[model samples]
Target: MQFKHPEILYALFLLVIPIIVHLFQLRKFQKESFTNVAFLKQITLQTRKSSQIKKWLTLLTRMLLLACLIFAFAQPYTASKNQFNTQPETVIYLDNSYSMEAKGEKGPLLKRAIQELIENLDPEAPISVVTNTTSFSNTNLKSIQNELLQLPYAPNALPFEAALLKSEKLFSNKPNSPKNLVFISDFQEQQKPFSKPLDTSYTLHAVKLKPQVESNVSVDSVAVTGKELGKLKLRVFLKATGPTAGTVPVSVYNNQTLLAKATIDFSETNVTTFTLTENHIPNGKIVIEDAGLPFDNVLYFSLNKPEKTKVLHIHHQDNLDVSYIERLFNNPEFEFSTTFLNNLNYSVIENQQLLILNELTTIPSSLINAIQSFIKRGGYVLMIPNSLANLQTYNAFLEPYNMVMQAGITSEKRVSKISYAHPLYKNVFEKQETNFQYPKVASYYPVKANTSSVALAFEDGKPFLVTQNQLALFTSPLNKTNSNFSEYDLIVPTFYNIAQQSLKTARLYFTIGEENSFDVPVAMQADGVLTLHYNEQTTIPLQQYFNNKVTITTTDIPDVAGFYQVQDKQNPISTVSYNYARAESKLSYQNLENLEQVQVSSAINTAFDTIKSDTKINALWKWFVIFALVFTCIEMLILKYFK
Candidate 1:
């Protein structure tokens, strides 16, 4: 038991005053003679003894009554040890990710958690609430009640470790303060295992909100699986959790018009395909009817009108085997052209997206300056060194990229290693092919390269092809006498993707909360800026202006998933789509009960109750008040009834 105002306890010393008054009676008694003194003397002795006992009883009761009143005024209470001296600090981590849209016993998990927090939390206690995208620090529940009620779901979920770190940072630095870190989420299983933090300054409590049913299906992804003359066959990937069966209806919409509708037989398959006309859907949406999670029920994608990438090849007039360059860029997606070094039109260099210097013996200083400026303006360049190329001239052009041309190596080396994870081959191959026919080069120049820059290596681990930002270099020329690389199957994707990436056009779609960059081909004034528009919402994305295009990079601005129009003020350039990632669609969760130094519960209110119990105060002052009243009644009975 502890006293709130212990200074009132000094009044206990006043009990000595009552004892003094009882022992030394201040009232004087008169002695008088009366008849029958002998019998009267015996009766007086009995009366005096009984009266003395009564006075002692009354004094004991009165002293206890005064002590009880003093204790009651002191406001004494019983509570957990050290709770009276420790200050409590609480921080709550609320997971507002899309997976929280799952239904619990009450309602949506996020919504129910919010309601419980508002209902159970101390209205005036200082607390901090950490969400995925926002934080309400050092605030009371009454102040952030409205904000918690309207909190929206985030596209990205904060990692469990990150959330723990964030919660700890919000706590006060005062030592020995009782800190409670409450984590309220569904405890979804992530790609990596949760590393438990070892900090002992705070107590960790986890409330795992489980859904009523574990069965849920989600639209995983949409991709063009096949293509024909004027139609594109798209496949929709679906993912299910637990035991889900039966056919689900899927619909494809272009703007407000329905393009096609189909049903996927879940009992037999997890995929369905739909064929639509080419160049028809500038803004496309694929939706599935599911009663599970709502965020992944629909997928958004954009297929804008195609733009041909410009390719220009500069070669020496003496070289006659330019068949490989011509055949690779012969598709309808690229506008391929060639020119001799003597006939190089410097005026057209700025318009081309990719420039291939095929077998150039000497790079003129004037042409080198033009190519350098072109590359600096977001253009790509591929350098194929001639067999007898002048090293001094080539080294001057390669000096800025931390590369140089070395003397030729007269050895036959086969191209055996491919950096399968390079951006050039991101999705080019389904798996790493180890048994493909290796292409051999009879004689080649040896150029040093950074370990990360080597996209393809020779059998001796020398760089056969190295690529830096906006530049790709081959150690040797591809002429039939020097190498047979032009005849192999590896040359198509290598050269084709270079031209394709140079344009930076819109992809099928992009995921939100990721670093997404693309180019908008529009000439803007020096002060002009680009903005994204989606249903009356406009946001200016981070953009870098170039000669004929603007490179736009977005991470967290356009948070909603939908088709956004890339606009220069009001004029539209193109359309791009953003969609939430499908990571939380499967509904797998982690079991946190076995974690060390953490208390696990299944409800938000229960977790709060545990925290409340830690600092709960059981006031003994009311019981003391009742004791004071009883002592007063006992003293009155002794004074009135005992005599």
Candidate 2:
């Protein structure tokens, strides 16, 4: 019990005044004659005894009544430990990610959470509310109630650790105050678990809002699987949680017009294919009908016009067999050309995507500078050293890439190992093959590089092919007398992917939170810039201007998932697409009950009630007032009826 005004309790000392008056009498009675000697003695003795008993009873009642009144006036109250002495501070972290779109018992989880928060929290109490994209700090619920109701879902979900840190920062710096952190979310499990423990300063109350159903079908991914005669075959991958069966409808649209529709049988397979005319649909959209989360039902993608990669090969001699190089890049996808070292045109090198230094005996200072400049502009280089090349001139170029060339090794080495995990060979082979045809190289120079740089290793653990960023090196020449690599099966994919990487075209779609960069084939003025347009929104993304293209990098901008036009001011260059991350589409949740030092509850109301209990005050002054009235009645009965 605590008191509002403890000084009123000092009034108990004043009760001593009544005790003193009862004990010491100011008036004295004179001796009176008795009617009869024996009768007077008996009457006096009985009367004195009765008077003494009555006076003691009345004095005890008066003291008890005065004490009760003093306590009542003091306004004593009982509450939770220390709740009456400290101010309560609250910070709420409301997860407004797309995963909250799942339906609960009443409605959508996010919508229902908002309604309950407004209904349960005190209107006048100060609080801070944090969400994935927005926050209201040190404000009352009445002030931000409308904003909470109109909150939109965010494309990216904030990590649990980040949200905890943000919530802690929102708390005030007052000492000895009771602080509470209410974390409300669906608690979706991510690829990485929340390993960081929560802070112990504030009491953490976690509310894990669960949906009624766990079954959800999401469009996992879309890719260009194959190409037919004049059409492009696209594969749509779908994922489902819980017991899913039967067929689901899938549709493909070009802008707003429906292009094709199909059905996927979950009992048989999760992937379905659609064939559309090549380059016919610039704005591609794939949608699925599922009674689960709505945010992942549709995926947006773009298919811009194809751009051919330019290849330029500079050979040592004009008569050397360059037909093999020509055959590799002869397709319509690549612009292939060759010239002898003596007749190489320096001006044309700036516009090429890949440069092949075919068995060059010596690299001039001027040509080396040109190649370095080309590489800085995002060009790729494949260097095949000549058997008798000048080591001094070669090392000069290799030094900048942290590579060195040693004396030539006359012993023949066979190329045996392939780094399948390397980006050049990723997805090129269906399976890992242990036994295959090996090519031999005679009279090869030994190139030493970092262990991670080796793409193809020789039988003796020497680097047959090593690559760094934008530069690939072949330790030996591929001529008929020097090596048989040109005749091997590995030549096609090895060269094809290297050229493909040189000109990184836009993917079908990029996730909103991942690192994505693509080249837009356009030349802009020094003062001009590129902007992404979707509906009425325009965003200026991070970009670097090059000679013939603009490299645009995106991470967090263009928050909406749709087809956006890449424009240089008002002139539209191309189209790109973005989609929300699929991490939350699986409908899997984390088990938070095992957390220590934190209060976990399944319902939002239960979590809020726990917080209220900590600060709940039970006033005892009313009970004390009733006790004072009862004591007064006892005092009146003692004075009137006891005698």
> lDDT of each structure?
0.88, 0.87
**Model 1, range 345-438, lDDT digits (tens) per residue?**
9999998889999889899999999999999989899999988899999999998898878999888889999999888888999999989899
- Writing each residue's lDDT as its tens digit, candidate 2 over 1-643 gives 8787888999999999998987798975556886677877787788889888988877887787788888889888776656655678899999999889999999999999999999899899999999999989989999999999999999778888898888889987877788999999998997665433644578888889999998889999998887768789989999998867578899999889998899999999999989888555679999999998898999998888778888999999755787888999998779889888899899999898899999889999889999999988878899989888999999999888889999998878899989999989998899988988899988788877864378888998888889989899998888988889999989999999888888877888899978899887676788779999999999999998877677899998878888998888898888889999988887889888778787988887898899888777787878877887887788788778875
- The reply for model 1, stretches above 4 Å from the true place, is 5-74, 81-87, 122-125, 193-196, 622-643
Best by lDDT: 1
Q: Give the clashing pairs for model 1.
A: none
Off by over 4 Å in 2: 4-63, 192-199, 318-321, 410-422, 425-464, 479-490
TM-score of each: 0.88, 0.89
> What is residue 634's positional error in candidate 2, in angstroms?
2.9
